[model samples]
Target chain A: MLDTYKKYFRFLVKYRGMFVLFVLMLTVLGVINAINPYFYKLFVEALPEKNYQTILNILILYVGVNLLETGIDVIVYLLGDAVILRAARDVRERVFKKIQDLDFAYHMTNSSGSLISVLKRGDLAYFGMFHELNGLYRILVHLILMLVMFGAINGQIAWLMGASFVISAIASKYLLAYNLTTRKAFNKQEDNVSAVIVDNLINYETVKYFGKEVKEQRRLSKAFVLWIKTLWGFANSFRLIDIVIGLISAAGLWVVLHRTFTLYMSDVIQFSDFILILGFVTSF
Target chain B: MLDTYKKYFRFLVKYRGMFVLFVLMLTVLGVINAINPYFYKLFVEALPEKNYQTILNILILYVGVNLLETGIDVIVYLLGDAVILRAARDVRERVFKKIQDLDFAYHMTNSSGSLISVLKRGDLAYFGMFHELNGLYRILVHLILMLVMFGAINGQIAWLMGASFVISAIASKYLLAYNLTTRKAFNKQEDNVSAVIVDNLINYETVKYFGKEVKEQRRLSKAFVLWIKTLWGFANSFRLIDIVIGLISAAGLWVVLHRTFTLYMSDVIQFSDFILILGFVTSF
Candidate 1:
């Protein structure tokens, strides 16, 4: 997997300067996502003082900051497109060239139907991998920024949030792996189904002469049964993750809300701080 | 489009009882989504009183509601899978039969590469359409519930939200249509690229005899260039929508926050109400 990622990175760096700009823009977007909630805290704090001018100014600033965030997001999206699309094109071209260069014996041995399916999926996988990793990177930045803000308010509460995130991450790793396994099984079955269709189309004359349309449909129906079963397993795994992670997060939320409420009661924090904490946890 | 949806619904109703259960559970899930935030308002209200027992009870109740939501979500996912998977299988089987039952001349004219691609995409379209419609239904439920809550507080604010939603939806409809056009163009180019590859593999013997591997590579490169162009167009269309909608929402946010802040300053509502308004808007 590391080797695969290294090759992906190699393609990514084909537009080295643009890729750097994309990363920087993404980090800015993450900062914006994290800090926007802080403005709400500002609003809540300003409300008690009847500071009309200050409140209006904060609202204006809040909207200004949001507009700026949107601007950055636009740039990030464009940069992401420029980088990922070029890299994807490079990957596809290389894959096509490599396939063309393969030994004749290899081509003869491999069914073109399955080979084409693999090629198509490989093309899609490149795009999926880039976006997934890009999203993960942004999320990491947002998480760190949020934790820092949480720690600034109250260290124990931040610790509670961090611990819960760690537990959730650990659980997600296993659950997502299981999901991937089932998904891979389903993909294989899907490929078989497609292969059946492609093969049937390729041998249409023979099938027409043999009058085996019903037989072909029966064959596809059989493939559909197993395909459906694997798909259910894949779908069920997703819900399993949802249930387990949902409960875990609920527990975390309960503990955090309780801790913050206690802090508020003891006068360790103001009501604004309480609202901010609530906003952050719920939004996250 | 109506006929298409009618066909989809016909397939969906194959598992009549499960489909009804799925829709009911989905509605329940949407209510849960909309109502959960009211508990935050309750928390804020309780904080001012320092009502320890009430706060603890609310906390417990919040967690319990979340647990129930998660439980319902699990059931919904399972039911969705049962309904959608079976419906999709039926659709696929029917499409396969229809295709097989077509004239041999039709099969002769259509490249199997593109035909299989169309079949595969059609199969996927069913699943995608189901999920997209289900999500839209949930959003509709959540939005109605939220608007009612907002209206109960301030009719003007509710009107503002409703107007913003309408504007955003209108903008999204046009932008998404353009995005779809670009996406369809890209899909066509992608099919062309794959057709080149599949045709090359099918006609390998003639290519090998002619030593035309480099020519095949050139053909694929040409297809890749066009495919990349369409993809960039599609990606840019999405960003256009994002920028427009983001700014519109920011403007809406500014107006609502200012109005709510003014109301709070005038003693028309409590700090908790301010917090609740901020919470709802930001989270939504």
Candidate 2:
């Protein structure tokens, strides 16, 4: 996976301009989204006073901002798509070239399916890394922005939310480690099922001529059942993790709400501020 | 494409029980999502009354529903993954078997790259068809549900939004058509680049022994330029289409907002209903 990602990174860097543009667009979009909660707060604050003109203006501005963001996002995606596809073509070509130049001993040992699988899975894993990097970056940026905003409004609540976030991160890491093991087991079972299906299909004519349809079907069915059993176990484990995570997030929300309400009752925070926090926590 | 889809359909039906379960899960998930707007409306309505207990209950219920939905979604994805991957494996095996069995004449006529492309792209196109079918079905289901919900709320607003949906659909279709053309051109240029790269890499030692590094680099650079020019053109065209579609969708939203406001002013709808419409309209 690391090697695959390194290769993909090198390829991406070869087209650095497009990637830079993509990152810039994402940054701009994130900034726009981060500011959006404030507009909503402003709109809600003006609503009770029957400020129709202010409401209309806010709505129009919100729509315009959303449109601008979407437009930029679309352009960025198009550019990204072109870059990725072109990169894949180049990589595939390189692999094919490498295979051709490889020694006869290498060809004798490596199955075509293995090579194809490597290329396919490697490309997917590389793409996964790219997406994960971007997602982690975005989350970190948003978290920092939220922290600064919350600290400015109410430090105690921000600190509480921040602590919960740290706990959530640690919990998520543990869950991921556990889940990865189950996922590997599930993947192996799936590979077995695929092996059976492939063997049957490659000799499909022979199976039909030999009147072994039932035999083949039974074999596939057995493999599939095993796959399902393994998957089902994984699913159950995943569900348990999900439930725990959900509860933790809910608990965090409850804490934040309690703090906000208590502060509001004590006249330390306004209702608008409370709504803004709610929006930020939920949206982010 | 049709033949590929038919073959995949047969494969899927051969595993009917799993397919049925997957579809049922998707439908249930869709229904849950369709009903969620109503829940949001209820939550908003309760907000003004400062019903803390109700809000807490709603929040818990929301988290529970989301967790349940996610669990179900994961299972469905696993099921689908098992089927599709197994099917792909079978197809790959069959293609390999064919390669083994094919006459020398056929092999001589086709380059290894072309054959590889056929095997890879054929299976991909098969998967693409399945994806397109699933998308079409989901869109249809969601559209029907939205129309029903919208009609129940306000027929005039529903009709206007429906019209906008039609416009969006037409625009999407046009964009897709244009994309297909550009994609073909881009693919052809990419293939050319690939051929050159493969040729150079496969003869790397020969080139090095003969000190042709500069010559090979120049050749590769020429291919790279061709690919870049084609890609740049493709991206520009795609960007133009995306911008147009984005603008149209924004305009559609404007129309929906106008209709919703008019209905609200006439007391034909409430603020909550308008919010729900906004959610549904802009979700795509």
Candidate 3:
């Protein structure tokens, strides 16, 4: 099953050109996203300096960069879908067809909700995984640029920022994984509700013959109550992740800023450079 | 269904005493967690000044706070279980007893995995929700303290930080909701699979009588193929969340840090004071 990743990739191999182009577009978009903030610094520096020509140039470049980013992003978005949708649909088709060939007993033992969740998420998951890989690649580009900028300002600060980002990223991964366990537990219960409703529906004749309509209702309601609870569990895990990320981001923000703050105080960097560094890092 | 929240709270009414105590413990724990980092700032400040006595005092208080935190956490852990288990068991007992009075058809209609999953997560969900609420409360408290400290350092910086956190939290909420919609779609497929399997099992005799064993196997296999796809969706959504958080956190981290960087450059803050602010914000 783990190797299914390879299978998915192979299935998507035909879209490799699109995927590559998507990556290239994302890189360009990222460069633009990072650089756009520089306008703030440039505008500020020029405002007091009364450098009309500089401001005009900055305005033109800002518009130019935005246009470029928008164009690249549009293509990246389309190519992402092309790569993911085509592969996912292909995989789904193959698997579902295989299921059509399966026996009844196999369907009986397998849970419908679980199966559907697996199937429905297939294409999106493939798409998401590809998108995530591309996103990470863009972030890497952002990160490297950030590091280089920090290093330019102060090597010590760059080292600290790099360490902080890496360490936080790793730690957050483990934390997110832990939360995943709880999410899975909730998902299992959700599948159960599907199973119960399904099993009940399949035995409609038996239920009717036994005159157990009221009882079936009670059973279904009971499952629903539990389903609601598990649903909340699933929802709350996202909130926890949000909180965790908030804390981690705060930590990372603190580490890098504090270093730069110290450097600024020591007169290592001027106010303009500080603004530039600040703008650049924020681009990340 | 919305009343379910009221019902859960009403069910937990008996544990009100425990809940209040839990909050108190958490508030204390939150305070300790927030203040613990200040020891470093204190130590750093005192070190440069050769204030050995202050450093010793900070160390002693640090250890003492940690010890207090640990002790409180243990009790909180116990109270958490007591509160959640009592509520969940009460609910389960009520539901299961109802199942006992149900007709045989009712029992037959319900799938075991679905039933067990509901029962298993009931207690945990109850626990997780309560934990999440408590955590959010603690975060709120931490956030207030952070904002206050920032205000103390520089009101403008504090405002920007608060704004960044709020804006990002809101943005992330919408982003997550979009992902949840996709997640729910996969959940639907999972339910279908559960239904397929459970329905087949209930009509086991029908399949046997028809000598349609091969067909039954095919049917089940068909359901499984769908299940695999949904599983991928579920997996991919989590990955998407990871990527989104990575990007959003970067954005938030950037806004706040950049502001502080400018503050330092303008001589609004000293190097030591800068470190202190950095240490404090990270506690959030």
In order, the candidates keep a fraction of the true contacts of 0.84, 0.12, 0.00
TM-score of each: 0.95, 0.76, 0.52
Tens digits of per-residue lDDT for model 1 on B24-81? 9999999987786687688767878898899889888877888898999999989999
Model 1, A122-236: lDDT tens per residue? Answer: 8779989988998899879878988898899999999999999999999999998899999899989878887777788788888888899999999999988889999988999
Tens digits of per-residue lDDT for model 3, A52-115: 4664565456545545554566566656665765566566556655555567678667865455
- Candidates ranked by lDDT, best first? 1, 2, 3
| Docking quality class, candidate 2 | incorrect
Which 10-residue window in model 3 chain B sums to the lowest lDDT? B112-121
Scored by CA lDDT, what does every candidate get? Answer: 0.85, 0.67, 0.61
Error of 2 at A249 (Å): 4.3
Off by over 4 Å in 3: A1-8, A101-105, A111-113, A121-124, A201-213, A224-245, A280-284, B1-284
**Is 1 or 2 the stronger prediction by TM-score?**
1
Go through the candidates in order and give the clash count of each. 0, 0, 45
lDDT of 2 by residue, A17-118 (tens): 998888887777667757655753664465455455775776687679879977777766776775676676566556655554566567456443334435
Q: What is the TM-score of chain A in candidate 3?
A: 0.84
Task: Indicate whether candidate 1 or candidate 3 has the larger lDDT.
Answer: 1
